[model samples]
Target: MQDTVRRILTARVYDVAEETPLDGLQRLSARLDRPVLLKREDLQPVFSFKIRGAYNRIAQLTEAELARGVICASAGNHAQGVALAAARRGTTATIVMPTTTPGIKVAAVKARGGNVVLHGDEFDQAAAHARRLEAETGAVFIHPFDDPDVIAGQGTVGLEILRQHPDPIEAVFVPIGGGGLAAGMAAIIRFLRPEAKIIGVEPVDAPTMKTALDKGEVVTLNEVGLFADGVAVRRAGDLTFALCRDLLDGIVLVDTDAICAAVKDVFDDVRAVAEPAGALALAGLKSWAADHPGSGTLIAVNSGANLNFDRLRHVAERAEIGEGAEALLAVTLKEDRDDYSRFLTLLDGRSVTEFNYRWSDVGTARFFVGVALKNGPAEKDALIARLIAAGYAVEDMSDNEAAKLHVRHMVGGRAQGLAHERVLRFAFPERPGAFLRFLASLKPAWTLTLFHYRNHGDDVGRVLAGISVRPEEQPALTEALGALGYPYVDETDNPAIRLFLDGARAGS
Candidate 1:
């Protein structure tokens, strides 16, 4: 089967219209003192290079098979590719997608003339349902990356890479979900250009191919993160596993933040939005480029661009830390609070990128802090030095996996919207002294309420304060609370806020 795929891929059936542009990234290249080029596959028709494999696999079907029609499962770009190709070939295609699939993706599939069905909660579930439907209807099942035809079709991407770059390509970075794209491309590149390294990129949270490579066989993840929805497969395909196991050079796992940073960089440089999976290749290149320099030339394949515009907020939230523009932190000991404050003050120019405090009992009082750095390592090192000078223990939450994923999300040691009886809302000039002043202004005698603030390291900050107030004092406090410089609105008047705030009221 592998031999057949190798031969078919060698006899390319279709061609890419225009070779993607590759150029040095001034910011990145300057930082590493090496050449960096981005392969703009996000610019392709259907906004993904998936068209290459979809067209290749479907175009090879016999007339009889075509008459029987084709069935497949995909979240977005792949579904569009199959639908468009089948329409072009004058045949029918049915695409199955998860019920949770984004509306934009469903619309894209329909736009390509696919008979779309939403089923299950994840890709594997959709694929299973597609298989059952195919068996019942006798439609030819088109595997996304597992089948020989699919893998061979994907290999055409590798051929295009060598054809596009005149130099002795040093390394090629390909994104992996189920390993179909990575496996096929790696095998072909190894066969044609053995010295040109083939590296597979997978999301750190969903390391399907990485797990296979580690175990020497395919394995399913107990849980898979859907942050990079396009490439969040729990298990890799068997054929792809075999190919990648024997042919690939290395596996690079990128976190959500890195992918977001890559997406932001691509948009900044070329005004293109790379969906998470699409940016994986660039993220992989940026991850390993420093140590693997001068292998010849570096080529990264931008795989897909089926992105949800609404999800951009989540991506932006992480991109700051990915680019080292922000630092994440976890502090230990309430005794160190004073020392920590002094250390932070010494970071004069630097700002607190993010800070969420919550009660913790780790044998010591602690709070997690996230700092933003306009400058580089110097500022971080100085802050660390000051903390140590003050006889405080410092944890560089930047490199702590627990802090980044679990701790940061679990800020304040509790969930954000969880409520209580009273919310003392306040507005203050977004300045360094503002928070301290608020703390000073509040009477500790009163029990706490929900406190929420967004500090963009700016001049004016918005704060929501929830406190436990006696039922009798509520009306008088509401009328008199405006005396403070900041205006206060009684959110309890709003039904939703009241319900949430009332729930947050702590138990005696």
Candidate 2:
């Protein structure tokens, strides 16, 4: 502990990293009913606290080690940190990144004079390749977490937090990837401020550290979601996992929508567009505040802000739902001109965020609708009850993952007599001709139906596709999908899809 403390105090990160401000989140404090502060690590040179550890690790290198060069595997922010740190030290970094890494991130590394090596489809594969290359080339491998010096380097953030706010703080939130920031900060905080809690945040889809803590050992995940690409690690670093397990008070697992909501909150309060992973801690903080409401001072570190401009559309679309400001519902009403008017009366002037209906000459009609809610869940529930009492069958689609992602933009449709129709969702790296290439890969025997895709400003392109085939073609179709080399989910049995894709009497 003394050695770790000494290393943190003497860490040579200031050469490339800045001591960012501890700023207040006004709107969030008012809403959460407590004083909320944000540790603005997003203000660093590389727009991430990663520069601290990256630069510190490089600083300790001997001239001979520097001459050998530095190599690392990162999906985004850490790559930029290492690139900038190497450039400042008069050397070039060779960054091995997953092919799925955002183009914006890949370009950032190149702009920093780092040689970019695009490798396998995910971070783990890229890291494996990097280690193999490191062993062969004899270049120094800069572990993103795991290393003691690197952990001490990141501990500087905790040093700054305590120095900046010496007053009482109920808890401090940190985002965990392979657990670099969380482990480093947790060690220092637990040592210095014994009463102040150190909590870690993780994406529910990629619970690297949380899973490790629960299992009492590190475990590799088969897959992780790419929504929060920065912290989407399949496995937690061995050292970091140990530190976080013993030091952190607890871990909070949040979903993508909650992350989107936190991004919106940061923007609303600080006028900053944090990348999904950057806002992760705040998302967890909100969950914590909700569960234990009080006037305690809470702080969450805004870890990074390397967001791609295109991804804002997705952030905006989900933010309302994430923050409970909007509701999505599937409603059935009698087919008539006055039906919508009657429905509007039931809403009592609440703003409608969306209304999608496919014109059909039938006795009843199904519509996908989005309504603005001022009272959040309570208002949403009340509205649903009113619609039901008025003879309008309603399905609240707010919490349905498929409904929010696809049905909102689904454009009402009733596919009739389509045999062996299968609805599937897929995601793949976005690049020139990527969509066309995927389209070309479809089997000649199966018919493509109900294809929906929109660019959500992510480096990954996602598509909701439906296919029709003969019963005999099922085996072949399944085999062909696996050959595509992209992860896919069978959405045919999803409740949201089943609701909208079921029998709709149209043109009767």
Candidate 3:
């Protein structure tokens, strides 16, 4: 390990980049009462810090060894780093990525002149395949963060942080996937700045390091969610696990929504988009600051910014509650139209962030409403009281994990008066007034049975709209909708939809 570290230190590829600015974040610093500094690794040449290790590790091979070329597995940022570094070193590089990896990442790898092979459905599978390819071709395996050389390369980041600040840093939050970055940073900090806290952050859905630490051994997760693909590692690397066990001060878990909120915050502050994993370190710091009150030097690594633009809306939808800026309520009315009117009136002063309603003949109609809150506990209490006064059963959806993830995607209400309904899949341009225009073209008295709209980042927006048609008015309704000249496909024949709706209704 020391030899690997020495190799890393001696590598000619090691370019001493200027230290990142540790400017105080006014909004976050004020919130946490701590001097929170953002390590702007997202501003790197590849818009990520992965290049440091990639270049360092590749530079170490002897002339004969370098002739063998190299192979590695990564979903995005790492692939770009290795590809670019290999190009600079005049060495052949091959990257294996999961088939599900985004096209943008694959394109970036190609743009950097790396031969990319799409393999497997997940990173682990792709990694395994990469190992087989390495064996077949006798290619040098550039283990992403596991090998000692890689860790040494990543440790440079810690060196830079310490040199730039030269202050009593209370904590440095580093994002963990396979524990490579965290392990490297932790080892350096533990060895040099013994008093500094090294907190490792992982997406809650993929807490490989935390799980390993809890088990007192490295344990591979059977399944991992890929929403935060940058950190959705199923298992920690062997060498990284060892370094992390010895060096890390603590491991912090941040949920997907919190990650989204942090990403949104970074984008707001610097107008730069960070992938979920990139923003995770900031999320951990914010979470830690909320619990521990202090004013000390804190650094959080902004790891990468290779996010798909299409996923922004989904992230935005969850950010409000994640940051405690909005409250989601599942409100059910006990009475008739009068009670509904009274409930709506109660929200006169509040700005409704999101409002979705579904009616049922079985009982009261349910409304999923999100309201913005200026203050935390006080606003929550007042809102609960208002719901109670208005005779509404309000179930807080703010912290309900199930509702935030699954239920929000699948569940909705039913309209009782619909004699006929037709489900249509429509693709319309996603612009400022697209939705309003669609509503304007619709005729009155035709009840909306179901509606789901999520942005896909393309000009075209996908929507599933269930239109209730009166038997006598069907012909005219279809004619009017057709005359509007929009592309539409009827999905009433889809077996999946039939089964889902039938099963849901039966269960209900």
Candidate 4:
């Protein structure tokens, strides 16, 4: 540990990296009643802290190793780091990336003079391919987080934080992917500033580090959510897991909606947009503050800004619910105009952010509505209770994933005579012909009942589809879907789908 700290102190990354600022998040601090600081690693030349480790690792390689060249596999940020680092050193680099990687990232790597090889559909597959290429070409493989040099390189961020603040910090939140950043920073913070706590943050859906710490060994996940693609690692690195297990004070797990809310919080305070993974540390900090009320100085690493522009719409839509600033409801009303007037009166002057209504039948109509909440979750629950007391049937849709991701956009009439219907939600690469390929993979005997798709400007495209199949045919249908090789969820029993599309009891 002492040698690692020494290496961090003498890390030779300044030629391609900068001392990013530790900016105060004044608005968030005031709201949370604490001193909140953000280490702006997003402001680096590559818009991420990955450059620090990448450059430091490449710079120390022997001349013969550089001559043999370098190779790596990454979905995005790390590929850019290696490409830029190798380019600066006047050496060749080959980057193996998932075919599902965003086009923006692929172009960036190519522009940085790295040879791009698109393979597989996920990081694990691409990494396997990169390893084969390394053996074949005799090139040095740059593991994103496992190596001593890379970890030491990233440790510099912790050193900078201690030097810049010069004040007693209660906790420092670092996002965990393969645990590079968290492991590096935790080692330094544990040794140099034992008084301060080092907390690692991870998406609830991809809690690789947390799981590793619990099991006391590295464990690969069967699947991980890709929304926060930058930190969607399936397993913690061996070296990184060892360091974080010994050094980190704790680990915090946050969900997607909370991550979206934190992104908005950062934007509100700094006028800078953060990708989901970039805002994960802030999300964890907020979760921690909410649970452990009293706070001192807290630091969150603003990790990266490599976001797809189209994804901003989805983030903006969910930020309100994630922050508990908005309540989504389904209220049943009579089709009469007077009932509509009465429904408006129940709102009690609160601003309505969104309103979507469709008359399912003549007797009662169900409307999907979004209302601004003045005092967050408490107010939302109170409003729901009051509405029910007033003899209106209501269902809260604020936390429903199906409602937020699909139902809100495709609320419509029930399909007539759609018997033995099964609904499935899918996520697949958004490249051209991908949808067509999926359709081709389906069995010809099944009838397509309903389909809804929207491009969120992300690498993955979300799809909601209904298929008409007899109970006996369900096994065959499942087999066909598995053959398609896309991540999916069976939404046949989703409450929102039942109310909006399947004509189940309204507001039930």
Candidate 5:
């Protein structure tokens, strides 16, 4: 640990990196009733702090090693860092990325003078292939977050924070993926600012480090959510895991919506949009503050800003809910026009962010409504209670993953005559005509009932569709789906769908 601190103090990454500013977030601080500081690593040349580690490791390589070149596997920010660092050193770099990586990232790597190799479907597969290439080509393979040099390089952020803020820091929130940044920062902060808390934040669906610490060993996750693709590693590095387990004061897990809210918060403070993984620390800090109010200087590392432009819509849609400023509810009212007016009257001037209504039967109609909340969850709860007391059948859709991701946009009348409808959630490549190709793969004999798809600007498109087929045709339906060549999950009985679409008539 001492050696790591010494190495971090002398890391030679400044040749291609900058000492990003530690700016205070006034708006957030005021809201949280504490001083909040942002370590703006997003301002780095490659728009990520990964540059610090990548450049530091590359710069120290022997001339012969440089001549042989470097190789790495990354889906996003790390690839950009390696490419930019290698370019600065006037050496060749080969970046192996998953075939599912966004085109924008691939182009960015190429623009930075790195040879791009699209291989496999995820980071693990691409990394395995990179290792094979390294053996075959005699190139040095750079592990994104595992090596000692990388950890020491990333430790510089903590060193800077201590130097930049002479005042005592109550807590330092760092985002964890494979634990590189958190390990590095925790090591330095534990030594230099022993009194300060080192908190690690991870996407709830990809809690690699948190799970490792809990289990007392690094365990690979069966699957990880890709919303925060930069920190979507299924397993933590051995070295990073060890450091984080020992040095981190605590770990916080946040969801997709919270990350989106943090992105909005950062943008509001600095007018800079942060990628989901980049805002993990801020989200954790917000969660911590809300749970345990205290007056102290809270530091959050704004790790990267490599956001895909098209994803802004999804982030914006969920931000309010994440911040407890919006509530999504499924309310049932009589089909009579007077009932609709009565429901509106009960709102009492609370602005509705969204309203989707569909008359599925003669007796009852369902409305998917998004209402603004002035006082967070308490307000949302009170509103729901009030509506329920007033004889409205309501279901809170705020925390329903399937509802938030798909059903909200697909609210409509029930499909008529589609017997034995089976709904499935599919993840397929997002390309031109991808949906049409999926439709074409199915036989015309099967009736399509429900279909909903929204592009989140990710490598894959999420689709929810229902197909009607008899029991005898199930085998053929399975074959057709297998032939479609996309990962899918059976959601035929998903409660959200049943409540909003399938059960509507039953209740009526």
Candidate 6:
């Protein structure tokens, strides 16, 4: 522990990384009824905290090691860090990244003078290839999070936070990916500000650190979500896991909606568009504060601002629901203008964010509705109760993953006689030829019954597709989908699928 602290105290990060400001978040502080602070690590030269660890690790490499160059596997931000750091050291960096990585990040790394290798479809695959290349070229392998020097360099963020805000804090929230930042920051905060609680935040789908801590060992996840690609780790770092297990007070898991809400919150408070992972700590902070309300000081790390320009629409769409300020519902009503009028009257003039309706059935109609909420869940519940009392069937779709990710976007009447149809959502890598490759691999015997996809400005495109097959052909269908080499989930039983409604299900 002492050795790690010493390394942190003298980390050679200043060569490229800056000591980012601990700025106050005025609007957020007001809303929470406490002083909220943000460690603006997004302001770093590489626009991320990865710069510190990347530079510090590179700076300590032996002359021979530097001469041989460095290699790493990263989804995005860390690759940029290594590229910029290695360039400053007059050495080359070879970054192996998944083909699903955002083009913006790929461009940034290339612009920083790094040799880029786009390989595989995910981080683990890319990491495996990087290791093989490292062995072949004798290049120094830079692990994204586990190394002591890298952890210590990230620890510098904690040091700056303490120096900038000497007063006691109720809790300090840090985003956890592979745990380098959390491990580093927790170590320093434990030593310097014992009273300040160090909390780690992770995406709910990528709870690598939280799972490890819960199981009392480092364990590998079979899969992880990639919306917050910056922190999408299927496994936690070994060294950093041990450190975080001992130092961090606890870890919090947040869904992508909460993260999108945090991104909006950061923009509302500081006029900065934080990437999903960048606003992760703030999302966790908001979740915790909601449960433990007080006028205590809280701080969250704004870790990066490298979000692609195209992804903003997804953030904006989900942010309202994430903040509990909106509700999405699948409602059934009698097919009459009077019923629609009564529905509006029950809303009490609340703002309607969306309303999707088209005649599907003669006597009954299903509508996908979005309404603004001023009092969060309570108001939403009250609105739902009002609808039920008015003889309308309502299913709250706000928290439904399939409903939120796909169904709402494709609201319409269902096909009358669709049979043996399976609805599936797939993660399509955003690259040239990817869509065509997927199409070429599909079987011609099965009919492509329905297809829906909307670009969310992400490296991975979310696609909802329906395929028709005879019951005996199920095995063949599975095999064909597997051959496509895309991640997918079956949404056949989802409430959001209107095909499961009365008319469609009756025909099938």
> Which pairs of residues clash in candidate 6, taking residues 3 or more apart in a chain or in different chains?
none
Instruction: Kindly list the per-residue Cα lDDT of model 3 for residues 1-508, writing each as its tens digit.
Output: 4544454445443452234555456677766666778888887777777888888888777888678888999988888888887888778999999998877788999999999999998889999999999999998888888977777777778877888888799999999999778877787777778999999998888889999999999999998889888888899988899878888888888888889889887877767788888999999988887777777788899988887788887788778777888887888875254454466568756655554554355666676666778787578878888888766788998888887776767655434454466777888665544545566566767755565655434677777777667789888778867876667888855665554543333233
Model 2 ranges off by over 4 Å:
413-508
lDDT of each: 0.73, 0.85, 0.77, 0.86, 0.86, 0.87
Report the lDDT tens digits of candidate 6 across residue range 1-508. 6777888999999988887888899998988899999999899877899999999999998888899999999998999999999999989999999998989899999999999999988788899999999999999999999999999999999999999998879999999999999999998889988889999999999999999999999999999999999998888999999999999999999999999999999998889999999999999999999989888899999999888999998899899999999899988877655565677668887755556554533677677787889889999999999999888999999999899888886664475665787878888886544545665665666655554544444778777667668899999889988988799998887776754432356434
The C-alpha local distance difference test score for the whole of candidate 4 amounts to 0.86
- Residue 466 of model 3 has an lDDT of 72
Clashes of each: 14, 2, 0, 0, 0, 0
Model 3, global lDDT: 0.77
Identify the runs in model 1 with alpha carbons over 4 angstroms from their true place.
Answer: 1-19, 290-296, 330-344, 356-368, 374-382, 391-452, 455-508
For model 2 the local lDDT of residue 63 reads 91
The most accurate candidate by lDDT is: 6
Clashing pairs in 2: 310-457, 311-457
- Return the clash pairs for model 5, or none: none
TM-score per candidate, in order?
0.78, 0.82, 0.80, 0.81, 0.81, 0.81
List model 1 lDDT by residue over 363-480, tens digit each.
Answer: 3445566677766556677777776676667788786767766766555423244333555556667666655555444444433434555465346666665555577766645554
Could you tell which candidate, 2 or 3, scores higher by TM-score? 2
Compared with the true structure, the alpha-carbon lDDT of candidate 1 equals 0.73
lDDT of 1 at 352: 63
Better of 1 and 4 by TM-score: 4
Error of 4 at 193 (Å): 0.9
